[model samples]
Every structure is written in structure tokens, then in C-alpha cells.
Target: MTVSAGSRTLEVKVLSAEGLTVDRKPVTKNVFVEIRAETLNCSTTSLGVADGARGSPSWNETLMVEIPPYARSITFDVKCKTSMGTKSVGIARIALSDFLGGIVPESSLQFLSYRLRNWEGRRNGIINFSVRVKSAMAPKYEPSVPVPMPALADRGSCGSQMRVPSGEQHNPRGVVTGIPVWWTNHSANP
Candidate 1:
């Protein structure tokens, strides 16, 4: 896949899951989640508890994923490992408008819950998570250190205000010229 240089980095926190079931039975062990943004690389969370404690499987893990700026949604695929093989539990798709839309600013944390659909497109469970855009691909224009413009500032004054000429010189005859005023270097005059 072609990756853009200005892709955004997402911090997706896989918080927990509730009411998850497969084949009409509650999930038991090695339950994990796979995150995807379109066709970009996928990130997976560590497996949850095996004993089916707390009435549900919980994986409070944070995953870092990079998504293209044009991606409109992300998918959360829940799966479980059985003695036979890895089984599909459910899938949850979250639209970009859900959190990345509206007046929300970048780097703002947005907590959300999405319903998971089983293989047959049936409601199976809910996935809870928080996501935030770490930063925009392009950095802001705020300079960390103050730039020193020695020629623009007066050494005698400690403030950052520009130094003005001591006095204004009037034309010899107070005559106005049709030539538009142009900038010239004072040092070049000498």
C-alpha cells in the first residue's frame, strides 16, 4: 500500500469488552483484538484473561497505529483462540466522524464504545476504547526559542519592540514625488 508522508498517528487504547459471545457461548481464553485503518498495518492487543473472570474479557492495552489522513474509519476485529484454531468473535467499525469530527481539536482524547457484529452481522458485544490524534503531520509555526533580530531591537532597551529612527528628515522643499516609495538598505547608501 502507498503510505503518505503526512499520515497521522493514532493512540488507540483497547480498554475492555462486554457481552461478547461466539456460537451462542461466552468467550473464554486468548481473546485479543486487531485494529485496522483501511488497509494500513494492523495492531493487535495482548490476549485477555482465560478463566472468563469479571463476566467479560478485558484488555487494557494501548496500541499505536498510523493511519492515512484520508482514512474514514477504523475496524476493531475481536477474535479468540480455540483448541481447533483462531475463531472470529466479532467486528466493530468506528467512523472517523464519531470522534475526529466536529470541533474536536487534535491531540484531544475521545472515549467511545462501539457495537461488535458477529460473522452473520448480528450484535454480539461492545468494545470500549479511547483514541487521540497524537499530532498533525505538519508541525505548527510556533517557534520554541525566541529568534534574535539584533538590527530590529535596540540594545539600550530590554523590551522586544522594534527600534525607531531618532528623528524624521523632511525633504528639502517638502516636495512630493510620483515615484512609489520603495525599500532600500541603509547600509548601501554609504
Candidate 2:
């Protein structure tokens, strides 16, 4: 007697006053759900199955949500559960900024700018099974325009080499000194 919700699948969805809000604020709502039980019958446990799957029994319930305004753009936690146990769910609040921040233009620069670096892995807890799509996108500067070398000015003349000031006493033991000009310009150099 393997009671099954015949060809059943649990679909998790979120709906609110509107798909978006007017004042650009988190639109609070009493979320409503319709549980369509198809396969599993009476005795089967909603333990677990697939990723992002709410391993639980079907129920028509309402949950409160604070859909943050786009200007604030936030991610908050929602505690969900089946008849079995509680699970942590994250709801992300999006706005114009979120949309713009995510859209990458189809260009070579876009490819070079946003590249995957490293993955630190997910959180650790009772419900630690989660995924973080770690990605980085940056604006690519066109190699500083190459400077062009000013056409060599005289061609037969000599060029200048930036020299460190000879008079400055360097504290080689205590604090490193005489760092390159560009290196010193950065905040982390000091």
C-alpha cells in the first residue's frame, strides 16, 4: 500500500497584491496557496525529494510576507515547514536596481568584466542545503587608452625614468618605505 499522490509534484510559488508594488515599497501580503495532491496517498510522508522542493504535505495556508521596496532591495528569511519539520526560505526583494544590477550587456567587455572567481560554499545549519550563485561583474577599463607614448617627442632624445627621492631615509626595519608611486596611491598599500 504505497499511497502515492499520483503523478504529484509540490510547486512552491509566491503571489501578492500585485506582482509589484506602486510606491516602490515592500508590499505585504497574505500569501495563498492551493495544494493539488495527485499521487501520494494518505500514509506517505512528505520527507524530501528534489532540490527547492518543500518536502511536506499539501495544505491551503496563508503566509505573511514583507516584499521589500526596490529602493531598499533586500533578502529576508521565511520559515516554512511541512507536517515534518521547519525549513528556512529566503525571499528576495527586487526593484529597478536589482533588475539593472543583474542585466549584463552582450559584449566582449561584459565577458571580461564579470567572471567567476571562487566559491566559498553555502551556510552551515540544520537546513544547510542551499546554493549561492556567486558571481562578480565589473566595468572593464580599456587598458588606460595606451597613452600613445606622445609620439616620442624628439625620437633621438632620451626619456625620463621616475626616481625615488634619494634624501628620504627609508625605515627598512620598522615600516616599509619607498613603495612605488602607483602602489602608494592605493589605500591598502599604506
Best by TM-score: 1
lDDT of 1 at 184: 43
Model 2 Cα lDDT, one tens digit per residue, 1-190 = 1112211111122211112111232212222221221212211122222222332222222222222111233222223343455433222222323322244522112111111111122221121111111222222222222122354433443333333332215211121123222222233321
Candidate 1 C-alpha lDDT tens digits along 65-128: 7777567889999999888899889998888777763578757888889999998999998988
Residue-level lDDT for 57 in candidate 2: 20
Off by over 4 Å in 2: 1-70, 76-79, 82-98, 101-190
Q: TM-score of each candidate?
A: 0.67, 0.17
Please give the TM-score that candidate 2 achieves against the real structure.
0.17
